[model samples]
Target: MSTDLPTRRAPNWLGAASAGLAVAAIVGEGFAIGIASDGGWGQATVLAWLVIVLTAAAFFGGLVATVVGLGRGAGMAAMVLGLVGNPLVLIWLLGALGTS
Candidate 1:
């Protein structure tokens, strides 16, 4: 008799939800910063969109890795990347892009 345990996998819903939350956090922060920085609604919208793209890219990368059984590292990397990069990029976009 042979006994073996199957490898654990990342839950699709959990992964998807985590990514979604990350994106939302980034966008929400951008919105608040934009409004406070005199960006108005339009500028805030643009900032939010930028964050969305960044998060989407991270999500896609993580998803691919997860499918290949490398989700642990990839998901962690994605979360870290989003948490670190989002604020930095948000500040830059708000200040540099301006609301003109």
Candidate 2:
């Protein structure tokens, strides 16, 4: 007699959420850049907070999905893209630009 194990897969919803949040992080970063370039501290502060939240969500969500092996590509992409939009990094770059 032959025995077989059932197939398992990570939740699709989690992967989708992670990918979506990652994209949002990128978009948020773009807005931050525009606002900072225009010297809009008021808007930039609010946007910084938003980007931080999005970055955190994207990174963690993608991590979970990647570990489970579902949507690995999307999860990895999210992690990379999320880091690219990190608010701390943005602050440093913006400061340097302002100084220069």
Candidate 3:
């Protein structure tokens, strides 16, 4: 038998994409809050919904990346951000709408 070595490639971009999406989601939520505070409930509602959807997508995408042996650090960061950010934004949105 010949002595040989297999080469390993760098991880794919899913983890980075997940991280980017999570950061975007957080910014979107902040924008939604600002809009709501400015008496723009309609716009805020739409933005909040969009943020929620993006957060979910990022969370799942990160999980998939991690399982696929990609950038687990970035993926985990995205997942944690989604887990913490989504609910807080949702609650704030709900409270704002309820009081309006």
Model 1 residue 76 CA deviation (Å) reads 5.7
- Summarize candidate 1's per-residue lDDT along 1-100 as a digit string, tens digits: 7588878755555345545556566667657576858848777766666676667666665566555545456465566556555756657778887867
Please list the residue runs of candidate 3 whose C-alpha ends up more than 4 Å from where it truly belongs after superposition: 1-6, 88-100
* Candidate 1, position 17, lDDT: 52
Candidate maximizing TM-score: 3
Give candidate 2's TM-score: 0.72
State the displacement of the C-alpha of residue 31, model 2, in Å, after optimal TM-score superposition: 1.1
Worst 10 residues of 2 by lDDT: 7-16
TM-score preference between candidates 1 and 3, better one: 3
Better of 2 and 3 by TM-score: 3
> Taking the candidates one at a time, how many backbone clashes does each contain?
0, 0, 0
Q: Give the Cα lDDT of each candidate.
A: 0.62, 0.82, 0.86
Report residue 34 deviation for candidate 2 (angstroms): 1.2
Between candidates 1 and 2, which one is better according to lDDT? Answer: 2
What is the per-residue lDDT of model 3 for residues 4-84, given as tens digits with 9 covering 90 to 100?
888788676998899899999999999998999999999999998898888998999889888886888889888888776
**TM-score, predicted candidate 3 vs. hidden true structure:** 0.80
User: Which of the predicted structures, 2 or 3, would earn the higher lDDT when compared with the native?
Assistant: 3
Q: What is the lDDT of residue 24 in candidate 3?
A: 96
The most accurate candidate by lDDT is: 3
